[model samples]
Target chain A: MAESKKPDSSRRSERSRRAIYEAALALVGETGYARTTIEGIAARAGVGKQTIYRWWPSKAAVLLEAFLDVAEQAAQGEPLIPDTGDLEADLKLVMRATVDELNSPPYDAPARALAAESVVDPGLAAEFVGRLLEPQLQLYVHRLRSAQDAGHVRAGVDPRIALELLVGPLAHRWLLRTLPLTHAYADEVVEYALYGLAPRP
Target chain B: MAESKKPDSSRRSERSRRAIYEAALALVGETGYARTTIEGIAARAGVGKQTIYRWWPSKAAVLLEAFLDVAEQAAQGEPLIPDTGDLEADLKLVMRATVDELNSPPYDAPARALAAESVVDPGLAAEFVGRLLEPQLQLYVHRLRSAQDAGHVRAGVDPRIALELLVGPLAHRWLLRTLPLTHAYADEVVEYALYGLAPRP
Candidate 1:
């Protein structure tokens, strides 16, 4: 519902929710996941502890929702993967965007914090993959399925697994810091993934 | 370096070093990288805190050495990747072994701990990647270079980047727990990476 149409209380609630999200993201980025607490987030956001607890079950839940909000704001209603009947260009565009997003401080710090926590916490990891990551991955799956229909990708390719070939290298580089994550690296990943590493006959 | 030539004091020092390594690994696995401390490791290993400090400058250093020890034990002096004159087979063999290692508790728990820490700690991540991971990855570089010489791989391909296509997916799956990492999955990654996702003419 639009804020103008909503009651004053509902509008206030929306403002509070956004505040909470901002607080959570900022706190996690500054302090790291292990030290970020509900009380701390509440104090930072100028909201009551009960207000946060009523909305989210745990610190993880709050942080995850906060991350989702950040990602949505970053997306700004853009279609995640554009389909222009050219699979390579489409994938490269998305991958380049991803490279930019990863490099951006607003996304990178909080994401690294969440990812670090997820490695040790299976429950959080499951919720993260299910709630945030899988849905985003599904967009690629859909795009790849369209590619298969267009005879761009092979018929036998599993979209889920195939998508990883594109995303996995970027993630590996970003997480491990093995090398610089640049637009050039992103383009290389797309090209390498689409074409075989072996001598193409 | 043989124990037979060592004096009594040297032998005792060797035993204490082994104890310290075991204690560091077990502590990191049981608690986590953040909680695992020099004092805790020393207490667990039945050694003085000074002994740990004397040997390693920090917990990260100690844990890294411990990890190297575990990896050495796991390898059992076997070459990390065997060049059996079949690049695909060799890659698959190593990937499958990696799948098993990631699945195994002894390697998995401590590795997850170290990896989690590395995400937030750039210094540790650099050391982990440089001292431990890069050396292992270099084996693949060597194998791929050999393949290039044998006319199996494309001459233009950079083996370092090319190797990520194979290793990245497995690391992504293992770390994220997005899907079950298996020998079958490893084989598919090998096949898809070699042959590409697009159909051959």
Candidate 2:
């Protein structure tokens, strides 16, 4: 198994895969999801049409993989919510980083385009949820469950639903553009979510 | 000064306006936002294209007005958050109603279509937010501010941000199909929001 023959073939395959991902991302960003096609991606990537088909069953699959690659690259920092033994600090840090991703250069167009498409198209939406969104959400579920065990979160709280209190507000701000998604806004969301809006007993 | 206007003219105009709104809604639901043209709406509604132009400047304006009319009709019995002076009850009431609307038959298709388009198109999204979303959100802001005055919500809480804590999780659940939005979930969201996620002090 170790002596798999040629290194050049593997190098060439990796390069082709990267090119395809780049092409898929760029095309979807530029032309919107409905207009992006396998042939077009192949042409843009300088790969044959058959090469794309050989890997992905459909355009949705191609774009889903491309988006995953983009997200992995963008998520360069370690897992977003770090447990520094202080739940509040860890939550704020994670929320702020998420705010930065929403507001900044790395994820604006491609994410917006894909999210928009998913809203109208249920089949595509399912694929998106299955491939990308759920995995990221599961990370938060794991973190929140840990916090609950530590007595930082209430014992009865459902970690899955509770995690949304942290993530959803940020997403709502980003998607609706109801207000500026600043670090300040992110801090406010974290504070309000951790310590309830109602007065302390 | 009482001026006498013909009842026939007013009645005819009302009929035409209703027809146009219905046509626009049905068209947008069947065809996605991009393909819904003013001419197509007029054709479907049995009104002249000039009539639609006379009332609204663009297809966006027509759809905006049409969707608002639909929401207004859907919200006819929609209870405003009942402030039995209990902020928690009021917030839970409004959110539970919202979950019903999001799950309802009338709102699902057209609302989803508009939201999908708004994601990719910022200008349209702004209009959708301004004309449709912001005013509805302001109702919550108004209610929350009242609660702050009554000492239910903390005085320093920004009502707009606080409202997101209530709205965001529900929207997230509905949009992502993450979990069933039920009475129990609604109550939990309100409870967790009113009391801190950390054990109560």
Give candidate 2 regions above 4 Å deviation: A1-6, B1-6, B77-79
Most TM-score-accurate candidate: 1
Error of 2 at A142 (Å): 1.1
C-alpha positional error of residue B157 in candidate 2 after TM-score superposition, expressed in Å: 1.0
Candidate 2's residue-wise lDDT over A1-201, tens digit each? 554675988878889999999998888888888899999999999999999999989999998898898778877867766877788888888788788888775477778878878877878888998889989989888888888888888898888878788888888878777788888888888788788989886
Q: Please, what is the TM-score per model?
A: 0.98, 0.95
Candidate 1 C-alpha lDDT tens digits along B1-201: 586888998889989999999998999999999999899999989999999899888999999999999999989999999988899999999999999999999899999999989998899999999999999999999999999999889888889988999899999898888999999999999988988888788
In CAPRI terms, model 2 is classed as medium
**DockQ of candidate 2?**
0.72
Question: What are the candidates' C-alpha RMSDs?
Answer: 1.3, 2.5
Model 2 lDDT per residue over B133-168, tens place: 999898889998888998988878999998898888
Q: Report the Cα lDDT for candidate 1.
A: 0.92
